[model samples]
Target: MSDGPTHGAKSFRLPISGRLLVISVPYFWLLLFLLLPMLIVLEISFSEARIGIPPYQPILQFVENRYLEIKLNFGNYNYLFTDDIYVSAYFNSVKVAFFSTILCLLIGYPMAYGIARSEPGQRTVLLMMVIMPFWTSFLIRIYAWIGILKENGIFNNLLLAVGLIHQPIAILNTPAAVYIGMVYGYLPFMILPLYTNLEKLDGSLLEAAADLGARPWKTFLEVTLPLSMPGVLAGSLLVFIPACGEYVIPSLLGGPNTYMIGTQIAGEFFLNHDWPVASAVAIALLVILLLPIVWYQRLEARNRGGAG
Candidate 1:
């Protein structure tokens, strides 16, 4: 029996100088910024809280002046589960993030479709308008919504003036307000990806579908929608992850009933001064956010394999 061709191969290695230059840059950056901070947070999450500047007890200590003692407290993680507040916060965050993402999709898809189908000259103008809000500060935009959603605000005033309603309806400090702000603020994120994907769609595909006796709506359902799924996923993750951990919008617009992970984490760290629990919450939140990214990568890999 002969050895197969796949059984033997030569592996190439980079030169010492090339390896140093190519790998060192990214490795150095990750070490300094991403890995180091994450490691510090991970270590802190396992330690007990104390009255100190940093608010967490030292994990490593000299035992008997020779042996090192490592203190790892898993109580914080347990507390997150045992406490109903924390559990509810996580659930509410996910719920809000999910519905907000869907709302963005419904509104953004049409806007993106319009922009992508616009004339070349008009498309640039439309895109600029879509991006124009970003030129202003995000904080300022959120504050502006308070004026619109407040009971005595312009929106209510307009409705009153037009005789649409006898009185101002309460809108501020509610879930509806939070959703409105989220959709408004993150609309661009959803639209940009969708437009990018929709723009590159081959026009001939639509024409071919039409020739084959497919109606516009049916063609869109069977052909266009399937092709634009990647953009939908990308845009959804872009909105959902950040919204899951959103602090500013919820703080400004949401009432006491709005329980979210970001607000709970902030409360744990700043108000309660529980550093370990806060770190644990943060780590859990980070893990949650990374899941979609992982899923996207796997899907992309499967797609590439199928394409190949």
Candidate 2:
């Protein structure tokens, strides 16, 4: 019997090879697309910008009688640290993203919970309604908000018709508009994760708590809320991180006073032609954003260990 496959030797080599291939593809794609691009960006971040030349240039010039050289410089990072404008933009981004994420959570949690507790068919329809808006172009959706929030827009017109306001309000080009647009855009992200988690929660546990003389609010706080923590964290991260880097909504809906890090990076790269500075800013933003992810992972690991 061929020694019974040598008692756990690599007899099924083809199956192992197939499994390895399946696992390796995704990692290979990630390295090629994500990791390599990030490494390139990091390298560019450290390089000095050449005057009258783009940030990246071939080492050897293809044309005759033309010369090219690549140089490394850290001045971009130094400038970023010394300048106050970039620092302020970074802080503003954090603040705006934080508030927007909180607002999404406040609004989405209840909606998600209600949907999850509904009948299965109703839950599917409700969730579909939440997600259906995303089928349209995101840019167009944001632009639609512009028409609604602009001076003499639909909101002002409606308010005026009801005699709530005699004149159009300057809702456009304000932080409030920015907040509205962000919350609207990211609400689905917050709701979907929450719904997924809450749907998985065992209703019997909640019922048991109620049976044990607990009120509805107490049962929610003690049982439902803690169980939904994973979804909350996941959804918040999804919304907050992107909101921090948002440029389009702010630019279209907000005034000149509202400047985000993403907008600043765009100005640095395109308007100022300061590629090194843009790369430095990008790197800094990456670090700032990734710290929370790292911290979250650590906290999650500790929680899992304690549970185990």
Candidate 3:
């Protein structure tokens, strides 16, 4: 008998042409939207610029005046490393991002855990409360902080009204204000991922550990913490990467003494009209951001491999 015409298998099988079309559409869209823009940025990053001219200066003499003269220069990158200000900005960006990410994780993890462990209906309500802040415009929310943190703002005014202080304290345009803004802005990013992972945890495992003579803390340390690590990694990366490149909050809340790489790059591009240097700074920021991501991916893969 010929092994042919499996009726059940044929019914379950999708058309080959349809499957190919489904795969091709997403690949085409990715290339068009994501890959193409990245390539353009990379191309511009390598191109040289003169002092008086923009990075992509048109060359009238080339290709019957249709083609632009594209010169490659690494001077901008060289300048980034050799300059003290840029180097300091790089370190400062990393330091602030790292600390802010840590703070967010510390604050968010407990909140997420509490929400995740609550009764199902209560958990839903609690999660909604956490997420409701995002419905407002992020920029507007950050701006609202300015009124609260300014020297003569509501915080100081209330304190003075209560006779807690003799004078209004300077809070806005300081590193502390920047930290507060960053933590507030990115806390949700940390909490959501952690809550998602923690919600999936099996209560039976903890019970089993207790039955096997494990203490509550021991069970959490050995099982719960390890299982929730993926969420921790995801949340940390989400917070750290963006915080490193944060521009608007830092600009609004921080003084000149608190300049970050993002502001420096913006200054180079807009204020100085130095596209090459701006691109260089952007590329440097990208590199710095990628290091943590790459490390996280490696660690994640290793953990998965060990688990498997």
Candidate 4:
């Protein structure tokens, strides 16, 4: 008697068709947007250069017998590997991304920790301040940095007024400006993830350490830092991936000395009109970036498995 209605209710679920429809919504979206573009780019990467709109020789051509002739061009891929300029740009992108991720971690961690420790009322305000940059257009924010970093701009003018320097120092159109723009643009990404991790930590863990006569610094090093590693990794990846392909910041802030993979890719596509070559370079960038990303994903999967 007790099991009859309850058991029947528990066993009931949405129809299989209904469940399949729900799953297919997001699956279809990913297939249409993400997977489709990747496949198209991968296809283009193997295409030959052609003179015309679209600018790439099709991979398949129909012969007289109705047999498809496949023309695969490895020249674009070969050119990327052979050219020292492309190789240097790849290395330069890695260098910039590495430094930017580090800087974001250093600057963001403390800010995130502070926010995590704050009273609930204050935490909201602090988070708002961190997110305030998003209120304005990202392009505008990047452009504004150009003015601030310029020799005759607000930063130099303020320094001059305070007698900190005899003349305005050159900061605009330099690698330093690129670094500044990256850190400013990507800092919040680092902070939000770190904050999410840190805020959820048990307070009693710290108390227990304090009770055991552990120094505050020692407790942090042992307890807090190790616990925040997941956040650190997530935030670093978030910053590193975008920074690697960042075109606008480097183009606007960096000089001729600061050529990156994005700049190289953009030049190949727009100026050279070599779609195949550009697509190959893009595929190569993804391959280069995959190392750290795949590692992180594997590590995360292992951690989740262990937790389960």
- What's the CA error at residue 156 for candidate 1, in Å? 1.0
Least well predicted 10-residue stretch by lDDT in candidate 2: 55-64
* Residue-level lDDT for 297 in candidate 2: 73
lDDT of 2 by residue, 106-207 (tens): 999999999999999998899899989978788999999989998989999999999999989999999999999999999999999899889989989998
Candidate structures ordered by lDDT, highest first: 4, 1, 2, 3
Q: After superposition, how far is residue 140 of candidate 4 from its true place, in Å?
A: 1.4
Sort the predicted structures by TM-score, highest score first. 4, 1, 2, 3
Give one digit per residue, the lDDT tens place, for model 1 in 1-308: 22345334321266668868888899999898999999988898999999988899979999899989999999999998899998999988999999999999999999999999999999999999989996778899998999999999999999999999999999999899999999988999899989988998999999999999999999999999999998899889888988999999999999988888989989998899998899999998888878886886776676466555
Candidate 4: tens digits of C-alpha lDDT, residues 94-207: 999999999999999999999999999999999999889867688899999988989999999999999999989999888899999999989998998899889988999999
On lDDT, the leading prediction is 4
Instruction: Evaluate all candidate structures by whole-model CA lDDT and list the values in order.
Output: 0.90, 0.87, 0.87, 0.91
Expressed as tens digits, the lDDT of each residue in 208-294 for candidate 3 is: 999999998899899999999989998999899889999999999998888799899899888987776787788888887788879
> What is the TM-score of each predicted model, taking all chains together?
0.89, 0.84, 0.82, 0.89
Q: How many pairs of residues in model 3 come into backbone collision?
A: 0
Model 4 earns a TM-score of 0.89
Candidate 2 all-Cα RMSD: 5.7
Ten residues in sequence with the least summed lDDT for candidate 1: 2-11
